[model samples]
Target: MSQVFDYIVVGGGSGGCVIAGRLSEDPNLTVCALEAGGRGDGTLVNTPTGAVAMMPTRINNWAFDTAPQAGLGGRTGYQPRGKTLGGSSAINAMVYIRGHRSDYDGWAALGNEGWAWDDVLPYFRLSEHNERFDDAWHGRDGPLWVSDLRTGNPFHARYREAALQAGLPLTDDFNGAQQEGIGIYQVTQKHGERWSAARAYLLPHLGRRDNLTVETHAQVLRIVFDGTRAVGVEVKQHGEVRTLRVRREVVLAAGALQTPQLLMLSGIGPARELERLGIHARLDLPGVGRNLQDHPDFIFGYRARSTDTMGVSLRGGLRMLLELARFRRERRGMLTSNFAEGGGFLKTRPELDAPDIQLHFVVALVDDHARRFHLGHGLSCHVCLLRPRSRGSVTLRSANPLDAPRIDPAFFADARDLEDMVAGFKLTRRLMQAPALARWITRDMFTAHVNTDDQIRDVLRQRTDTVYHPVGTCRMGHDALAVVDPQLRVRGVQGLRIVDASVMPTLIGGNTNAPTIMIAEKAVDLIRGVSRVAAQPHNDAQAEPHVEPHANYAPQARTVEARHAIA
Candidate 1:
């Protein structure tokens, strides 16, 4: 006999962990979580600096590659996702940031009720337990632990000084009243260890809850549907194929890239695409794998004069050994560093409603996603466009579920995006040239000689890639292209819901992890039929000024022409 669960959460990533953990809290309900990766409790996932080693190796990452992008000069970009219990959160740089207020308000403007900044702020507060802040804007009792950087490098202070020198304000809290400023970031850490979603919501309750079942290394092949309703999932576990029955619902939280792939593989995509792939159609949802979006990022690297920055050398190797010992004993020192230690938000134009660009100051020379290494110590800065107009899709490479899906982000397909990248490059260059940082820079390793707009564009076309924040594939809304409704239920299917970053109608203005957790936090309410009301008081002062949905600083016709030409 097959054991039945009231709820089955697939892919124990950021949203999966939260959904499973919250649903299992009811002693009467049986919840099961299926993860396609190993337990995320290893030392590498716990140590903040461990990401440096994990980025280049396939240790716990599904380091997939994108289809060659025309906008990127036919270069294939790298896409590394966490193949562990916590998913990408386990392998991500631990910076914790909630996007601008208008990001959620924009969702409301797009016909997603109950998702405005006022409505979602409570959920964000509910999921966070910030160590340094306890106010109406923040919650003191939550599952996720957010803290200040324990090992504050000297270079971090210098980065802030440079930002001020470049005419940027210093903000103590990026997640507070305002987001447009520069400062050291607060990370998802607990007493200096990485606090992944598993550590926050799932790990402590694993064995204690008898109704909760967690299956690791279980790969789900397809959704078992009875007509239009999702009833169960076909999974392969430990060399055996089986069906896990869901009595009430099945939540797909396999992330932005894989969630749509899972849906398409289950014969629930565009009818023509499914037929072409030789799969019988279960549903004819044309929006299943469309609307792919990601932040297009470019890095500025320079040789550093200080040994404080990370590098490959005998002296640094010896320091790492001592740091490891210190980490084991006190949980403090260089091992606690999340490489992109300091960053903040900025608006390129003063008239913009919210920040259009985000900066990440790194203590290492990261080339090609850390796949390429430099011999000497250095520092780098990542400038990523907060919102991009380009769109792409995820399609099935084959009918087999084991095959990786084809990803096309279509970066800079819209000319406005390229223009913004160029402006952002110039702005970031000014910050890098500030005396605080320029004093340590020995020589420019990437873009020193480039001066003209065409030269900058050429450099961006050759080197730009993702910052790992992809969203909007299975976007939620009431539009013709919306795959999921405002409640997160698959529009044409029953007993199925998507609660990951994929459901975002538009990408948020900052990191997506915290918002993804908030999605699950609100999802449990909808699943349980509970009336969820905002707990925090709303203030118009914190509200963002209204702006058009797809407003861009560039002339509209030029951008449209560029988009059409690229298409």
Candidate 2:
């Protein structure tokens, strides 16, 4: 007999891992997780900095690229997604951040109730075991471990100094009372090892319950539907097709790009779009792939003289081997740092309610992520736009699930977006040239001496790229354009739900991994009816002073940093 499960979670990513672990807690409900990638068993993934090389490699990552974005000077952006058991979390920089309260309020405003900042804060707290903060916003007992850095290199301090010297305020915690200013970023690490979703959720529950089954290298082609309700999934394993039945529901945690693509492949998207692809329409959800959003990042590199540089290539071949040996032995040294630590949120203009841009300081002079340079002494500061007005879409290229979809982020399509990015670039340059950074700067490496607005704009256009935080493809809302409801259930389909970054109505102000996990926690309550369906749309007027935008950007005018992957 074919295997049957109570919950079949497609794509064992951040959300899938959490959902599978949480739902299986009952021990009676059978849960099965399907992953397209191989197992997560490599020294490279366990060691903090060792993941750098594994990130871009085909062995562990999907390494998908976007169709040329019209807004980004027609350049096809590179999108790297994790394919391993832990998904992107396995290959991420492991930064842990919950976005500002306003981010959730925006969702509520759009008709998803109970998703407002105050309502969802508990879920964030519930999923975290923070090493610091035991007050209202944080938790002390949770499966996931969140902690501050135990050690810091010289470069982390210098970067913090630069932000202060640039006239930006210095805040101790972005997740605290305020998000503005610069400080060291808290990471998702335990004893210098990456605490990925697989490690935190799956590993603990594996083999403990016969009700849970994990199918790796099993690529799901489409959901098996009995009329309008999803019955199970059709998958391919070892080059052979197999079908499994779900006694209860088929949860889609396939993420932003894949969730929509899966829906379309299952004939659940716009009627016309699916018909055009010669697929029978299962459900006509017009918003299956609309309202796509992501954060775009602009990086500034500088050549520095102090011991602030953290490039591994700076040392000799023997020295590099020695460092690796040390990391293997104790999980300490430069290898443990995520490099992207030391970031803060800041407003481009003083009148804004909350900071619109964020900065991440890296000790390495990452030219193509340290690919070409044999050795160099420099630093990189990446600035990301917190909120963007421009939107994009994902559409099916073919009815086949193996075929990738066409992704158009529509990045800088609006002139106002260009203005915001330019402003961010100028502000970041000011931080780099701050008196605190003056003590360490040997010279400018990437964009030499940016004094003029035009110069800053030019540099921004040339250097801007993705920080890998893609979201909002299958947005949650009450409108006809919304793909899913507040509970993350697909609007027109039964027994099918999307549970990844794809369901976000708007991108959060910070990294997405932690929030995605929180979404899973929130979803559990909604599915079990422990939480109420949204009674009213999110109220911007009711939002605290921090989250409401002083001015709303035209959907086409605002630009965001195209940071889609994990930090």
- What do the candidate models score in CA lDDT, each in turn? 0.88, 0.77
Model 2 agreement with the true structure over 173-292: per-residue lDDT tens digits: 567666777778888887777888888788777879777888899999988999889999999999999899998889999888888999889888889989998999878888888888
By lDDT, the best candidate is 1
In candidate 1 the C-alpha lDDT for residue 77 amounts to 93
Quote each prediction's TM-score. Answer: 0.94, 0.91
TM-score of 2: 0.91
Please give the lDDT score at residue 521 for candidate 2. Answer: 85
